[model samples]
Target: HSPYFNGANKSTEVDYVQVYKDVADLLEDNDYDDGSYGPVLVRLAWHASGTYDVDTKTGGSNSASMRFEPEALHGANNGLKVARDLLEPIKAKHPNISYGDLWTLAGVAAIQELGGPTIPWRPGRTDGTSAESCTPDGRLPDATKKQDHIRNIFYRMGFNDQEIVALTGAHALGRCHPDRSGFEGPWSEQPTLFSNEYFKVISEREWIKKELKNGGWQWVDKNNTDVMMLPAEISMFNDKEFRKYFELYAKDQDQFFKDFTNAFAKLTELGVPFKGDEKVYKFETLPVVVT
Candidate 1:
């Protein structure tokens, strides 16, 4: 019963439920952004897996390749070291668990702890050895690009239009740091609590394009100017295909939660090799906060 070679090449046993708890416990920090590391942890998991190339079958979360300098130093990955560093202690405590598993699971923990849906997840990713495993640059979507560019990026990762829109709804959490992404502000007023606010923002708010002091520009709310949306996010509204789903999500929080969770679960699991019979773990979330 111990070996249970779920998907890893070697025999290993991991108590993923305990790992989930540990990651969840670490989500809150009064010193970090939004007093929670949830958003960046989600970003870390996303960047790690978003590199997948469906045609070539290369890249993805399979190897936890971001541990190598080449991938970590990639422009799209800027500032993710903070997420990795936070999870380092968790990794150190559980040496048998691969970085691929830890990073993805941490993302799930972040979402659930932040009042999002429970993500279906399993383990079986192993770390790669060298920088050679790093995916090429430009694989991740550019925040400055528009609809065509957004489609090109996500399409390569095998996401269709609906999934594409559901995935981008993740922007609801965490603000963009000007120092990191050369953009600033949260897409939603409640940046820490995950909800359909991002969809609502895209559909309802009138955004004004603001030129940042850093020489880059993003759309800020016409009224507030504090919250913002990337050019790529705006594309969701302009494109007829992408517009359909975000419009639906903005109106239906339950449907948004369902689709977003499914899309995100798929995102984290991209290219991860797991045995067909591997247990799908739906880790329990913290009790709902009564505010």
Candidate 2:
């Protein structure tokens, strides 16, 4: 049952799973900046889902209103419109799909496109009204904090320690831009592919304190001249408890993928409830073709 080949336009006949595959194809076709689109796609999904607050019910992925003024203007949301704009053509092709669903689907697309595990996604999320716009600026995690801070921010969004570690595994896919997060360089050289390289680097490399030219905390890898890490990311190494899971993930990529997929699935569904049994979709993996 090909998506473009059969029943392409029937609204009721639209398979959400096919939409996921279509977005995956698009991501593979347009991987830029780091040889892959994985990182930005992960960040796009995070920014979209991070807006949810369990207590207030004020923000969540349901709205897709980040297209509006105040939410788009958020300092934490900087560099994200690049991702949203990249998806505009896809949205244009499939007007019936909500932006909420599209953004999350893009994340799944990026992951599978870059050789990650299957992410189970569903389609009950609908676009919200313009009135339902604007989340506070600091809803996202600060890259300068420690374990306690990570716990506070993520816990506020209903994530546990395991989920936090799993979600942070996304660091393996994208680098911190000095312009965006004020952190420079990538966690792994292959920042586009999904893997447990972040943990491997932390466990295997020797880190030296980076010179502070502009009063920011950064680190240099003892083994490599170019790789770096943020204070927040390094804390995963400094803390005893966090390091345990990090080491486990570092040793096994498959375990990391499994844990990450489960955690990401939970992360995207922060405040939504399923009316029936939950369904998980496994996407096909693309061949590794070097260009």
Candidate 3:
């Protein structure tokens, strides 16, 4: 299927599984934060899909609408341009794949390669041409807010408490950059690798609030200054509604991985209506020491 439809039958097929492997290779960067592009790739995949609105059913990864002006310029999308720019070369190599699929696939690759769960994917999303195709701001979760805010946002995407907890488990793999999200530090010690470490750390560690030079408050590990958690992360464990699954995932990592796979698969498919045949791949990450 053509990623972009332009009034002509321009559909072409590219071996996207190979493309997924290529994406996995690109994610390893020794100089970048935690020696991997995993975190940012996760963010890229997330922002690309998180725009779903149950009421209007307008946003999602279907159009890759973030490529347009106002969508790219939204405050919530601050610093995502880097993720888009990093993916440019892959897009150049395979022009037939739409940005929607490319971005979403990149995320799936990051998760599998960085030590997370399998994500089922299908292609059929067409690219949108203008800023009007972009969604309004405020669809993503704000790390500074509490449970209610997290619920309002994810609930719009049709996630329940358990699904929300499972999705938040992704915080296991990424960190917050002071420049990007106006916050700092990784949620888990091994920030590059994906694991249930996020749930473990949030549930087991003691975090103390510390103010940055800019006056923003973030929770730091009492044992490690390099580790951190956001208000949103803390709320999951503290709030009764989310804690059941939150604690469940923390105690049982295998369960977390399974739940995350299902939740993430659904998250990416929010507005995508696929043709009957779609592919599901459980990508195997190359061992850290690849000869």
Candidate 4:
């Protein structure tokens, strides 16, 4: 009885961890944003998994439905084509892996490669074969909104205040592009790596309302306007409950890693229907390890 059975004869053993890692090996590009595909890979993984609806077990990473129209064209998913394209070659080589598994796994690999916690991921999300499986837009958080909007968005997805704070730590990894999200700048000094810096900066940085060249408002670090925080990010400080958890992460990186791993593990698996008992593997970090 071999594990990782993909319903293919149930006999041969495949090292999906290595397959995922090999795929992650190709995530670097000198010409792209952040000098690596890590940021967009994180975005791709996020947009894919962020669509889960708790009330109705649908719209998660299970099907990779974002490949289809409408969902791919969703205003929120703007500029993700690069991430998808980066993963395509790997998909071509590993014909057995589903788009859902490849996408979510790539996210895990990206986070690990970027100095994040080791995420426990399972590979049972089969490819979403039909366009009907696409989730509607608006499932993800809106950067322009405040606490109520932020809570409404995440709460609908079954996340509480503490988990929401932990998940926002991912902002530590990527910057806002005016072309994509109509917002600009990195949340941390080192935008490509994962750390509790987002929380730390959110708490300590002297911020002020600044309009980007694109004409959108965001809180920018007074020291360097090139660094910014979205309204949603600022909401953590404005709201008391959120601030408590935010302060904790800012002071303690280790605890943040553990909470983020737990919250993100739950997030990536939203709406995914695994067998009663399935093994979750913690993928090894890619050697291209950044700060």
Which candidate leads in lDDT?
Answer: 1
What are the models' TM-scores?
Answer: 0.94, 0.88, 0.93, 0.92
Please say which candidate is ahead in TM-score: 1 or 2. 1
In model 2, the clashing pairs are none
Which scores higher on lDDT, 2 or 4?
A: 4
Q: lDDT scores for all predictions?
A: 0.90, 0.77, 0.85, 0.85
Model 4 per-residue lDDT tens digits across residues 218-250: 999999888899987787678999999999999
Model 3 residue 245 CA deviation in Å: 1.2
Most accurate candidate by TM-score: 1
Tens-place lDDT digits, model 3, residues 133-193: 8898889999899999999999999989899999988988878888878889889888888
User: What residue runs in model 2 are displaced by over 4 Å at the alpha carbon?
Assistant: 1-9, 28-31, 212-214, 277-280, 287-291
Candidate 1, residue 155: the lDDT equals: 94
Clashing pairs in 3: none
- Candidates ranked, most accurate by TM-score first: 1, 3, 4, 2
Query: Model 1: runs farther than 4 Å from truth?
Result: 1-11, 288-291
lDDT sort, best first: 1, 3, 4, 2
